[model samples]
Target chain A: MKLPAKAAQPNSENLPFFEGAEKGDLVLPRCDDCDFVIWFPREICPECGSQKVSWFKASGKGSIYSSTVTRRIPGGWSKVTPFVLAYVELDEGPRVMTNIVECDPEHVSIGDRVEAVFEEATNRDGESGPPLLRFRVTES
Target chain B: MSIKGKAFIAGVYEHPERHLPDRTLPQIHADVALGALADAGLSTSDVDAYYSAGDAPGFGVLSMVDYLGLNCHYVNDTETGGSSYLVHAQHAAAAIAAGHIDVALITLAGKPRTGGDAPGGSGRAGGAPEAPFESQWGMSVPGGYALAAQRHMYEFGTTSEQLAEVKVAASTHAQHNPHAFLQDVVTVDEVLESPMISDPLHRLDCCVITDGGGAMVIVSESVANRLTRHAIPILGTGSFVKSSQSGRIDLSHTGAVRSGPLAFAEAGVTPNDIDYVSVYDSFTITVLITLEDLGFCERGTGGQFVASGALRAPHGELPFNTDGGGLCNNHPANRGGMTKVIEAVRQLRNEAHTEVQVPDCELAVAHGTGGSLATRSASSTMVLGRSL
Candidate 1:
């Protein structure tokens, strides 16, 4: 994340990463042992324990688990609460907690399916970077 | 890992001013300490050891040992971040079981609630700079969760409405708790309308902040028996660390997946055997993850399991978070562990009041998490039941 491509800054700072609506590619640090893709990419491969880790792509389709819609956004990040907070199980294996965006924020139902669509935009960090990965409710 | 008798939580106290008179971490801690001890009708001198999370101005074990003018056999100040105090309780029980110390006191107090973080207090308390990749990528505490929450949504059919159920249930408990800070009867619509702090996470999805402190005391089976006719002994405790997140584990499963079995084996019980639960709900995800991880539901099915109405009662199912929890209750960040454990203690001791409580509750379990899901987060669970 050090001097990352900006979108990758959050990937580096390792906390409070703000991204726009377009960075939807499920890219993360990779495995040196097999170069297999890893979610929440980090130093080593959970498979081979290889220290040589790099970014890799993820399958963006999965089912919606549970989600919460919040009304307040503290720390000046308001304007989106009472919004949906979701836990989606990726087709790849990890269950990610995130927001489901694009369509009617409602009409999002349990078991209603989704697919990742990247919306490219700059984050508040001033990095007109990678398209944020946002989920749109697709098929059941 | 095993308790001979029920270790009832006899003392529970909070000091909002431990950050200063009006402000001093030690004083804040003392208020909670004294309150808990007084509630239990015990004296400071009767306390044998101390346990806590985070660092204060002092540099020694039981930093306030002399300041509080008390001394004992063992003490724990392992700043394992949020779950530190829970770990301290487990460690204290272990120590007491091993004949190390008795009448142990575990407490927590910090300045973060006052809108000011102490120097070098980044959960690591200025420990070694975090691993380079995490720091280099600029990933943050909530982001890791966002990443996981996003993944969970991707895999399961969970929805915002279900997550709202958690906060709603917790707020219901908070409404009952006179001490809880955020007790608004927010609606699912309201929660949905809240601003997005992170995508998928509304501001309400996060825990609230308040300046406060807390303390708990544990003692040996013998001392506990003499002091009180009834005690809620710690039956079994477990701490599991996957160490590094290579690839074998999924974000949806917790160390509890491993620890729950180990703890059950140690305690000689099953999930159905338990009556109530005090889950650590750092966010909606933590609860979702643990629900599946703790075997409350099968993997990949947690989303359905939670929203199923099985969690609600007369259905007579086990109640969870009974005290509003970190989500709708005490979320002092560092004291998150203490709050869950204390609530479990109160329920087991049959002490929680109306607005939220169990009738003649007996058994309960508490879980705590320290690091973000992206890293080596420590997961600890303690199974508590009343001593007959």
Candidate 2:
């Protein structure tokens, strides 16, 4: 099946809780009561349980915590199995799970270093979805 | 006066006749109920309450009593997703503690969701309101997780070899389980050499398709006294939902991060205290993430943990997946969650045999994930400390 379309909007306006990935920007929720970074980006901190929070971007960098290879593949996507999915510990102190492109899958391992690079996948006609964020190996 | 004392799981069972293709959802429920009652040595006449979780109607004992030839005073159809039934069990225990029912029969079954398009999927749930980011382009759960796998490779230098190692081990263990669907040990070479489905998550790394039904009977310590002699106590349990397909965040730490800790705190135990574990392996990566999330190892260290020779058979500390996980076993839709519970009970009951069986184990944990990672998910952990 096709991926969910909710993630394709470009404008993050008036939206309940979402923002597209921008260059050099790591978007997260900030507490209105007492500004604290919240990765899950909520109206309130799951911690203090506040209702007011805003989004801000930060540096995207982290180490690979763990990963898995999906061979059974997902729905309507048999051709895309045998892939590597991982959880990256962002240096900003928040971990973001994303795709690792442009590298040999065999070279990936836990604790290996990485840097976030935004790549836009266009579905032809110069029309594109949201800015897709991927990670690349970091120069140790 | 400790609240953490053992609680009895009065009855538990699967479908009686094994494969029943023509069986209706309600029919399966009746058979499962029969088996669980038999195990508990209590008839429907003894049941004070019944619980069900599914996208169906006429649940409760009303739809089932005809099969039981008896009636119940209490009934419930609380749907919490596939993981909901286990959640139902915890709720039943709470009700028992509160004197709501003498014996609560908690059962979960789905009408065999025939394959088609994934939910809220197939081009997105735009409501004229697609989430926007993934809709414009194609990004399913597989694609979302693909991003995570790739990031892991880029950051921690995780290799495909490490992932293949997990799949291989799961397959090896599954070989011993008669219920497993896919046999044949999958080699690391076969996994790596396979085509790239989503860059990092290959075809083998994904879960499978199959149909299954499971039911459980939980009773108050008082009701259980009159039920059966054999009882598996529920030492402790916990449940939580982190994100529900809401937004993108860490793909690693699940709701389990909170739920797992809660169960441990309630059980007065830790990961090391676990004797056997039936971790939900929806995909090979899930186990790796769970290892780190559940505190089995430090973050980013799960790859090394699996690669650790100490976990190898005949020497390893924890022997997981005695029945083969979703990766190797039958992942019949909602069955993915119940399998963990079933295995935990089986192992605790001295039922596991062949390859992955632990000699004589007590104290086990089974965990399952329901719902998507981007949004909300229910992660439930049950600590079964044998009291027999």
Candidate 3:
């Protein structure tokens, strides 16, 4: 799917996060000093300020912490209308912002179980880029 | 030592014309700053310190100082989002009390509509950077606040209609305000029927976008005593800033949870003693969250408290945002806090237009929230009392 060029480019600090998504794994940084799972992949642990951080695959399972239906889409957001943007609290104890696909925006509710899913990302000009992660409501 | 009652607001002014499409940003800053000094019965020559946002019009505080042609010994240009000016007041009070300075001027001016640089949104760098991962999801301003609204509903059974009550009350006040951008009386039904920006927040839930500026002159109690105009005492102040780090945010509460009590304790009053409130209303949820966090009601009872219409009309148990607030009134870019301060000053002095005036307003709370909910945020609250 088409994504903004900003969405396609991963900064140096978060490169490993995108690299894992390409391999179909939801990897998050885990702090060795504090056992804190850091999302958005920082070099140092926010909880304990330790440099001893490593990437590990997450359970790929989470529940909707909170959500909103974006009826007003700003420029560069892939022209998706009435999509569900949500914060998913993963089983690994970190929350990530992702879009909920495969269902109507109004149908998604807080505390609903979801699973991480990755899709091929394309630049604004339709060039291939890193894989983007999203979430889908799991079947009951 | 506490800074309580050490500083007083001598003068305040909100530019009468909020939408200045043709004026330059520096011009807005100059106009409001000078206008406020005039209101205080003082000139720039009497000011010893200047306080403003570093990112304000004309670039940083020095540029504004240069543009305004003011020579000051001290300057503070802290940028804490929309609440920056309120925080500046807090800092100014302490500085004055400590004998660091005698007179302080806090200014906020931006051209959100005319200058092509609106204040709210996520794309800025510095301070708290956007999560590289979350930026890809394409979140809007309303969407960020919507997450908090959604969570509040999930946890406390808050209803959309209840949120609508906030808009309705603000509109009721706006109807009596001539300077308000929106004056047509709006009902809860009308708010619910308005176009939705996010799920629970409608177009009416959000503040109007207008380009304007406001200024305040804060002086030491000694200087206040000499001034001709009545001095509004700065009784208490509190502020808190939170980064967008995960696991630290309780969406149900906000930084106001910490700042509110500190201000109240300093002011020697509780929420029950407040005669009027000027809590920020960037969105309906902004007001609800602040009301709960500032001890207006129990944490989960904001929906019921607001729905009672206790915040509306001539007999509101606790009159709030009586000057139309940011919702239907003028929102000068992101400097919504200064207007909140001005409203409190007016209510305390019994200078508010007759319709929205709260009789014998003795204590007023002016609170502001900036950045986004569901992300890193900043909050500042101030308690102002009429000098006895």
Against the reference, the lDDT scores of all candidates come to: 0.64, 0.63, 0.84
Write down the C-alpha DockQ for each prediction: 0.11, 0.18, 0.63
Please write out the lDDT profile of model 2 over residues A1-140, one tens digit for every residue: 12222233444342333343634355666778776666544455655678788776666777776554545544443454444455566676655555555566566766778887666545445565445566776742
Task: State the displacement of the C-alpha of residue A95, model 2, in Å, after optimal TM-score superposition.
Answer: 9.8
**lDDT tens digits by residue: candidate 3, B163-233:** 99999999999998899989998888999999998888999988998788899999998898899998899
Off by over 4 Å in 3: A1-8, A123-127, B119-129
**What is the lDDT, from 0 to 100, of the residue B153 in candidate 3?**
94
Name model 1 segments beyond 4 Å from true: A1-140, B4-8, B15-21, B60-62, B118-130, B136-140, B247-249, B312-316
Q: Candidate 1 residues B311-374, lDDT tens each?
A: 4421336678766777776766344777788778877777776545677676778888776664
* Most TM-score-accurate candidate: 3
Residues B1-388 of candidate 2: C-alpha lDDT, one tens digit per residue: 2225435786677542334467676666676777778888887787777776553335344666555565566666654455666777777777777777777776544434443223322222234332432233234555555555655556666677787777777787778766677777888889888676666767787666555566777877777666545677787788887753333355546788888888888888899888787777766677777777777777787788776632333236776776667777766434466667777787777777646667667788888766655445678888876772
Best by lDDT: 3
lDDT of 3 by residue, A65-138 (tens): 99999888668563776778889888888777888888877789888999988877776678777777888999
Best by DockQ: 3
**CA deviation > 4 Å runs, candidate 2:** A1-140, B1-3, B16-21, B54-80, B111-137, B227-229, B244-248, B309-315
